[model samples]
Target: MNPKVKTGISAAQTGLKAVKIGKKALNLKKKLPGEKKKATQKALEKSAKKAAKQEQKTEKKQSCRQRNRRALKNTKGIGRIALAIWNRYF
Candidate 1:
């Protein structure tokens, strides 16, 4: 093989070996800060999702209650007329 091709193959082999050993020398950044930021972002996103779900549940409960109350109130007059008709028939 040509020297240049041989050098490239050797370099590739060395790089693959380095990868198997974790490549600690190839690191460009301190690990802690990046890890901390990633963890913080994940927690924030999780809490936001939880809060959104809680708010959705509360909204569903409130809307259902409001609808039930409105429907019952709207039927109050009909109920009274119905009762009066029943009394007259009896």
Candidate 2:
């Protein structure tokens, strides 16, 4: 942003600052239409990667929980069949 417009924003409302913005502007190159498509494709790829990471994280957590549950059942003298029945009904 132009410095003149930056300071004049708050001062404009009070009518105490000189507004000299919009007089001079930088000419920027317009983006190609194909550039936008590529950007969106990149964004979607990023989302898919993030989802895969989250799925792996959840899978790891579930496996850890299962291991802990098995250890608990074993410590309590619960048989495999009993554990399976308890898990199915509960």
Candidate 3:
């Protein structure tokens, strides 16, 4: 695979590990007051929504990349044919 893609995968894995560790740390803490608990719940929900949006964005970008690749492939075939015709004439 591409080096950049590998690096991104590695970074994502590290981030996942950090999030897991953070959750564990949070669990170790003493119970928070009712208001604090509600605040934490809201924050977690917000973060979850943000992550979902990011995932959808990533998927859209990947689909666009695939479409661009397909377009380039089609153009490359036409380009080669044009080059052949030019070489034959000039």
Candidate 4:
């Protein structure tokens, strides 16, 4: 196998190990006592806020059609520079 593939496998293994550790910690937290209702409420609110932001970003990406406008603006700027150079040297 190629050395790059081996390196990638090793990195992935390390990431999986970290994820397992994180999951174990979360499990322990769930088992250990506390106000369960409050924890559940906070978790739900955090997830809702995250989902809202993701939806907003997706909507913006879908409808924010500014690429053509930006391209036109850039061409206008280049044309000005080109004209100035031509006027100065020609």
Candidate 5:
């Protein structure tokens, strides 16, 4: 029922989606000639590593956004309570 809870759930869902998409994209399968197998495999490993690093960066950004949203929500609630108290006493 709380909007804050809804936002937290949405944030978790988005993170899961990002992880799933990243895993799907990194699922590489390519048929190569016997002579080029070693080189292709090496390249694939390098690319997969790069993709994983990028995915980590994206996940970090999403987590940061979620933290910021939660902090903002808490502050807004505190500010409203402060205002109510100020009005009642002054």
Candidate 6:
């Protein structure tokens, strides 16, 4: 394979992975953060709520990570498909 073509395919795969992460994060943020409220209180309850939100954020981050991983894996699979098509035609 041409080095330039390989570079282009890698860049495209990376861009697609980023898009997958962005979509996952946006969807997770929508699912979270809405029903929560802003309030002040004693130390323990405040800390607990803060912890919960932090956990949600962590989960969202992990979800994005998983989505990106899947996208990259799928990108490799698609690259093989493209190669197969190229071999068949040319």
Clashing residue pairs for model 6: none
lDDT for each residue of candidate 3 in 4-90, tens digit (9 for 90 to 100): 685477558657855875584466344787777777766765775676567657756776787799899999999999999999998
Q: What range of 10 consecutive residues in model 4 has the weakest lDDT sum?
A: 58-67
Assess the local accuracy of residue 36 in candidate 1 as a C-alpha lDDT between 0 and 100: 69
Question: Which one is best on lDDT?
Answer: 3
Instruction: Give the alpha-carbon lDDT of every model.
Output: 0.61, 0.53, 0.71, 0.65, 0.69, 0.62
Best by TM-score: 5
Which 10 consecutive residues of model 5 have the lowest summed lDDT? 22-31
Q: Which runs of model 3 end up more than 4 angstroms from their true locations?
A: 1-30, 79-90
lDDT of 6 by residue, 5-42 (tens): 75466557656655665565555555655433122223
Better of 1 and 6 by TM-score: 1
Residue-pair clashes per prediction, in order, are 0, 0, 0, 0, 0, 0
User: Each candidate's TM vs. the true structure?
Assistant: 0.55, 0.46, 0.53, 0.37, 0.55, 0.50
Give the runs in model 1 whose Cα sits over 4 Å from its true position: 1-32
Of candidates 2 and 1, the better by TM-score: 1
Q: Which candidate would rank higher by TM-score, 4 or 5?
A: 5
Candidate 2 lDDT over 23-69, as tens digits, reads: 11111113336666566556655655565566557656766777798
lDDT of 4 at 8: 67
Error of 5 at 88 (Å): 1.5
Error of 4 at 6 (Å): 47
Instruction: List the pairs of residues colliding in candidate 4.
Output: none
Worst 10 residues of 2 by lDDT: 20-29
**Candidate 3, clashing residue pairs?**
none
Distance (Å) between predicted and true CA of 81, model 2? Answer: 18
Model 6 residue 83 distance off true place after TM-score fit, in angstroms? 1.2
